[model samples]
Target: MATGDNLTTTAYIQHHLQNLTFGLHPENGWSFATSAEQATEMGFWAIHVDTMAWSIGLGILFLWVFRMAAKTATTGVPSGLQNFVEMMVEFVDNSVRETFHGKSKLIAPLSLTIFCWIFLMNLMDLVPVDFLPMLAQKIGALFGADPSHVYFKVVPTTDVNATLGMSLSVFALIIFYSIREKGFSGFVAELTLHPFNASNPFVQALLIPVNFLLEAVTLLAKPVSLALRLFGNLYAGELIFILIAMVGLWQLPLHFAWATFHILIITLQAFIFMMLTIVYLSMASEKH
Candidate 1:
């Protein structure tokens, strides 16, 4: 075991990285997983409770703060919160204007929500990694639960499922608008036609399978790439934070230095996710 913490380096790292999962256990039936091994046993049906709770909580917070800002907004030299909210709104509005050429009013609000919600979620990583988890462990202790079994990961974006859920949502919108803009035949043709069309109908027929294979991979990659990119970046960042915490006395300085640089990574990732969603939807909405 390491000095201050009773866990070894490997155990400490694992503890910080694991999510508080809840699902149906074969023997225990429906219950919360107290450990990563138990979580794995809980299987495909298991949900990351911490991820869902934090993501939803931050989403509601974003909405509430923005709503309050909107309510308290004034034309006469607006307050600080209103100014900040307006600035964020303008930032997203401009990003959408530049990137999305689509006609739908949904893009602007959606972009704003995506940017703010994701930024807020990523923002959780800036908190000391052990802080919330330790708090959770203490809370568990009060309930007669072992501290060793309490797992809680604060940053939602670090979880692949959270990122994948958001990306799959954008993917659904992409498909919906693609079909709406180009019709069912046009959508099917997009997958089966062009990108390698032939003048002869017979040759074009042969190209359909190849074209569909290529296009299907391309279509699927949108969500897969979006999810992995966000997950990979944040997961690496979280891992580094966990590693740094193992350094004992010198963790604070290193944490600050890394966090200072990480702020850019966090904001950039959210912006990239937002921009990609807009661009993918824009491509879908276009009458090509």
Candidate 2:
């Protein structure tokens, strides 16, 4: 029974990690109707379902941690979880204070949430690639499907859609804050006139159009840059893991080595995303 086919080598590792895409059908042709249909057909939906569950689960867990820490307030001494939460809170507060001069009530808490949520999502990379997928496959088999047909990817950050979705949300918040701080006319004037003020009515009109266009492009670039930076690092890291896994049993040590190194990449990418978020919000709060 112990044959070469039964061995979980690198090729098997890479194959299991690959995404189940919808476009450009394989030799078998289009097997499902909708994208969701295709996902269900290949058990890709299982991965999405599991990712959502885990992300939300982790979020709720952290929320409870903060809530409990807040409720059990102590002035004399701090211990265990309180000390840990206090340290993280102080770090986030410092970043917020340095980067943003706006109200602490909103900005500080938002930054803290961003850091914690993103860190939890990034931590998913630490989980063995095969662990959750295998569990999902087994669950699917019990529901009358073949385990071999189950296809799932548990890492949320590896998903471009998910990462871009988060970036876009920050993008929307930036716009909201800009409008709130500047007022509608003040915001429009800043975009169209402040950067290229002209005393004469004729010159002002001409410069306004050009300035607005430039400002619009600059605003658009922020979210795109934010989205791509996060997506690129995470996707590349996931790809490297897959490639390394393909190196067979002899490369086990190398695989562990790369995984250890990737821990830094994960944390750095999350921190970069958070910093960019703060920078963008700060820019939005500016006069021009």
Candidate 3:
């Protein structure tokens, strides 16, 4: 079966990977891309409209669903949605309780949000890859844009920017928690004196810079690793789906097989992201 755009296999995969971008056009001022070359040139200045749209939309949807579940929760017999929500809540609460040493009213809720929001974003990969983009093409036609140029990638977690944005947010929380739990002086001391101790004044002074550099790298690695791990996994999964689609009708069986196994990968990645976040925050909240 031919794709809606009737692109060759390579072009189809490239098109699927392209984000629906909007950016400053030299000729058109702020405008959406009318060509892949233009979108590529937009580069760092361009915003991935599709990724942002789906990410924010899914986040809102997650909050709304949980809010509704909480609002309608009953003491007696719980409905299926309520039961599912409670199960997720209890799971996140237990995970945080087990991992987080310090008390914060925010950890459990944060964990819940991370798990659900990321899982929902990752869930987009399981959609038939061409369906949403095909819809986007139709929408582009209404705007008098060339339908073939209207690229839309629906999986937010597959985008590095989205992953890094979330990781950076977690990094900010870690910093805030570190400052709140340890005073400014203590936090600075940890950076300069940790993982190395010297009794002599001159030796301690000499080690401060070394310790700071090492610790800074370690601290920075958290967000970098978190971002890359999630992005790599989901992006690879999405790429596999796109590749499988290139095989024409033979893609159906492979698609089903890969997607079935990918469900585990998706859930595990979400859980790992949530758990690492909790652990990192817990470490920050500690005095040592």
The TM-score between candidate 1 and the true structure equals 0.96
| Cα-based lDDT at residue 25, candidate 2 | 36
| Candidate 1 C-alpha lDDT tens digits along 1-288 | 232356778888887889999999888989989778889999898999999999999999999999999998988998899999999999989988997876888989999999999999999999988888888888988999888888899999999999999999999999999999999999999999958999899999999999999999999999999999999999999999988877878998999999999999999999999999999999998977
Assess each prediction's global lDDT (C-alpha) against the native: 0.92, 0.73, 0.92
Note the clash tally of each candidate.
Answer: 0, 1, 0
Write candidate 3's Cα lDDT for 1-288 as tens digits. 245556677787888888888998677768898777888777678899999999999999999999999999999899999999999999999999999978799989999999999999999999989889988888889989898888899999999999999999999999999999998888899899988999999999999999999999999999999999999999999999988977878999999999999999999999999999999999999976
Greater-TM-score candidate between 1 and 3: 1
What stretches of model 3 exceed 4 Å from their correct place? Answer: 1-6
Give the better candidate number (1 or 3) by lDDT.
3
Report the lDDT tens digits of candidate 2 across residue range 1-288.
011265466446544554434433333454421243455455432335445666678778888998899788587599788898899899988887898877747777777877887777777776766667777667867977655555566776777666777889999988998999899888888789857887999999999889999999998899888888877887787776666655668447876887899888888887788888998998888775
TM-score of 3: 0.96
| Model 1 local distance difference test score | 0.92
- Which parts of model 1 are misplaced by more than 4 Å? 1-5
